[model samples]
Target: MPALFPLLRGRVLCSGALGGRKPDARVYARALAQLGARAAHTLFVDDLFVNVRGARAAGLEADTVRDARGLRRVLKRYGLA
Candidate 1:
């Protein structure tokens, strides 16, 4: 993953949590806030409702999708098409 983000110019690791952990929204939200982005200005997309709910709890707009078709529908509904 570090190789994928070699620039590492605007990245920060706030918590000691692993990326593979479930309900990582809290960690992500904190990192975003630390980087100067309000939760309301962020969008979180996940395949699991648990993660989505966690993100929403952190004040971000969250969505869950079961598959690619569902993701397309969600993007279209939000005028992201």
Candidate 2:
């Protein structure tokens, strides 16, 4: 992410690596703050389904993607690209 998305740098939670569990809404809230957005208006793009699901479960729209193009499509779908 740092290499490909230097501009989007922010807090990163590696919760999936420790356990396939979702972070709570509060965690998402703090994370979203780093991006200057609220969870309700945020879109999380991740390659792993578990992470995507976790983000969704935490009250943010999310998508499972494999590459930058896929990510771009997601952003475009949300009018963010």
Candidate 3:
């Protein structure tokens, strides 16, 4: 994963890499705040409903995706792609 950082750079967060034992949107929200982003304004994308639910619970907009194509559509909906 360390070697892949360059390709995956820019505002990406991973709980396992960050030592989180479980998915927690509050932790993600705090990280976003530290990075100068508002939780309400950020979009959290996850393939798992549990993760998505956690993100929404923490005040972030959330989306579920099964693939990159699905993700593109979601982004387009938000004018992000």
Global lDDT of each candidate? 0.67, 0.69, 0.75
Evaluate model 3: give its TM-score.
0.76
lDDT of 1 by residue, 1-81 (tens): 234256446653425543334466657656676677787876667788987888787787879988878866776777664
- Residue-level lDDT for 65 in candidate 2: 90
Number of the predicted model whose lDDT against the real structure is largest: 3
lDDT of 2 by residue, 1-81 (tens): 335466555545454443434545555655666557777877777788877777888889999899978877887798866
Stretches off by above 4 angstroms in model 2 are 1-26, 33-36
The candidate with the higher lDDT, 2 or 3, is: 3
Ranking of models by lDDT = 3, 2, 1
Model 1 spans > 4 angstroms off: 1-25, 34-36
Give the TM-score (vs. native) of candidate 1: 0.61
The superposed Cα distance between candidate 3 and the true structure at residue 49, in angstroms, equals 0.8
Ranked by TM-score from best down, the candidates are 3, 2, 1
TM-score of each: 0.61, 0.63, 0.76
Best by TM-score: 3
Error of 2 at 39 (Å): 1.1
